[model samples]
Target: MILITGSTGFVGRAVVERLLAKDELQCVAVAVRRAGPKLSERVVKHVTGDLESSTDWSAALKGVSAVVHCAARVHVMEDTAANPLEAFRNVNVQGTLNLARQAAASGVQRFVFISSIKVNGEATQRGQSFMADDTPAPLDDYGVSKMEAEQGLRKVALQTGMEVVIIRPPLVYGLGVKANFAVMMHWLQRGVPLPLGSINNRRSLVSLDNLVDLLMMCLKHPAAANQTFLVSDGEDVSTTELLRRMGIALGHPARLVPLPASLLELAAAIVGKADVAQRLCGSLQVDIEKTRRLLGWTPPLTLDQGLKKAAEGL
Candidate 1:
């Protein structure tokens, strides 16, 4: 039996679908806040529980062979919580520990943690990419909380003899994806001339389908036990080129203004929009050679294929 937390979320749902399609695994369980629609016959049980509390999750943990934790409090616009770090810690850190401890106590064989590449921070200087063994130096509340959660999970694994596998993904996108990437897709479809042509920064991203494949491989692969993995699509794309490709996928020409990046940074700083500048001009990349050699895995879809699929759905 495999128990999956956050099974209703974007990534979690994809994992469940992939597991079901293969029909290799049986006895699926999900932990959710509230009981929603029913899943297929493959789902053996669903428990309505919140991760923030020390809820009774033993029943769900019982008889479970593996657990994949994908629940998290993602950052968003218009958030006004006082001490945002506290809010993220309450759920991402404490809540994660709670589940890991319970899973350990229940003698679960494997625990798969879905962590973000944000734990390594937004960008690396001189176009260097982050590797798996590098010491994590996160820059935000969200990244800090995830790093803390990884530490806590590692502690549990050490004491309980349970296998722990960590997967750090960068900017996952796919059909039904939301947030800033979705907004970019909307702008590309509208033929809006964005002033990001001058930004030559590169960023790495992962497709949801590709991420799901890696997760499944980690579940049973012997080399994945007690290993930390950094995964991406094995390619990098600049902000302007990314938008241009999206335009092509959407059957529209890119309308880009070749404004200097320095000027945009200056304007954003003056109007309290520095966050936008950081994201658009950020240089974040990941080295996935370890993942390829260790697990013998490769991304099933390329960036172009994934982008076209996303465009078709929109």
Candidate 2:
């Protein structure tokens, strides 16, 4: 038996599905704050529990061999909480500690944490890529909290002798993905002209298919124990090229204005969108060499394949 938190989320849902596809995995249990939307029959149990509080999860974890912690307060737009950092910390940090403590008490062996590359930093420097061994210097509250959670998990591992595996995925995208990427897809579908064509910043992105594959591998892979892996689609794409490809995938000609990034940054700053501009224009890359050498695994889908898959869902 295996326990999966946030099983209804996009990545979590993919993990659950992929795990169930394996005949060797008998039971799959999920902890959800609310009654989960209907899932396939393969999901054996749905346990209702909040990360903030403890419930009787021993029944769910009785013989659970592994636990995947995927629930977190993800960064979002226009959140009006008095302290968004505290709110994020409460869930991403405190909540994760609660779950990890419980999993340890229940004798769960492997704990897989699905964290983001933001925990390392917001972006990478020109011609430099983030590596697994790099010290974490998070740029945002979300990343800070994730870093704290990783530390807490390590403490639990030290106390309980449970194996901990951390996966840092960059710009995960695919069908049913909401947020900025989805908005970009929608805008391109509507033939909106974007000035990002001139931006030469390179960003590493991961497809949901490839990310899910890595997570499944981490569940039982001997090499993944006590390791942190940086995962990507293994291809770097610039903003302009990415936008053009997205347009093609959406069956629309790329309608790019090709404005200077400096001017665009100035305009966005005047409009109180400096943060947004930086994110869109930033270059963030992750080196997946460790993942390749350690796990001997390769991402199966290419950027074009994943983009077309996402476009098909639009």
Candidate 3:
């Protein structure tokens, strides 16, 4: 049996679907604070209260051999919490540890954690890609919390012999995706002319299906035990290229207006959006060779194919 958290979320929903489609997996369960109508009939749903350090998970961990933890305090453009780091730690670190410890005690064999690239750093310098073993340099509250969770999970593994597999992926995009990816898709569908043409920074992104496929493999693969893997579509693209491709998916040519990067940065700074501008103008690439070498795994879909899928859904 496999128990997945956040089954109603974007990535979590995809994970649940993939798991249910496979006959070998047998039984599937979901941990949710609010059980939705769509999931109750399909999986064993546990409507535990809010995710916190004190949240009881005894009812959810029963007979579960593995866990796919995808729940977290996601990144936000404007943080409402008085202490954003503490808010993130409440769910991402303490809550995550709570679940892992319980799972370990309950004889759960393996855990697959869905972490973010921010656990490495916000962005990389030109020609410098983040490797799995690089010293962690998390920049934001969410990243710091995830890094702490990784450390905590490793410690749990040491004490209880539970195999922990961590996957640090870049931006994940696909059907039913939200936030920045959704906004970009909405604009691309309307053929909106954007001012992000000249940016040439390479950003690595993982399609939702590719990441889910890796998780499915990790559930049973022996090589995935107790390892941190960096994964992507193995194709890095510039902001311009990404926009252009999304345009293709939307069946329209990208109407990008090129503006100098420096001037754009200056304009964003004047408008109190320097942080947003920095994300758009920066590079965040991951080197997934270790993942490939260790697990002998490859993304099932190429970037173009993934784009086509996204386009068709759009």
Write down the lDDT of every candidate, Cα atoms only. 0.87, 0.87, 0.90
Off by over 4 Å in 3: 38-42
Return the lDDT, model 2, position 144.
Answer: 90
What tens-digit string does per-residue lDDT give for candidate 3 at 186-296?
A: 888888899999998988999988999999988889999999999899999999899998887778888999998888899999999998888788888999999899889
Residues 252-271, candidate 2: write the lDDT tens digits. 97899988889988999999
Q: lDDT for model 1, on a 0 to 1 scale? A: 0.87
lDDT of 1 by residue, 103-186 (tens): 888989999999989888878763789999889989888899999999989999999999999999999988888888888899
In candidate 2, which residue pairs get closer than 3 Å at backbone N, Cα or C atoms, i.e. clash? Answer: none
The estimated TM-scores of all candidates read 0.96, 0.96, 0.97
Q: Rate residue 179 of model 1 by lDDT.
A: 82
Best by lDDT: 3
- Model 2 TM-score relative to the real fold: 0.96
Location of the lowest summed lDDT over 10 successive residues in candidate 3: 33-42
Candidate 2, overall lDDT? 0.87
What is the Cα root-mean-square deviation between model 1 and the actual structure?
1.3
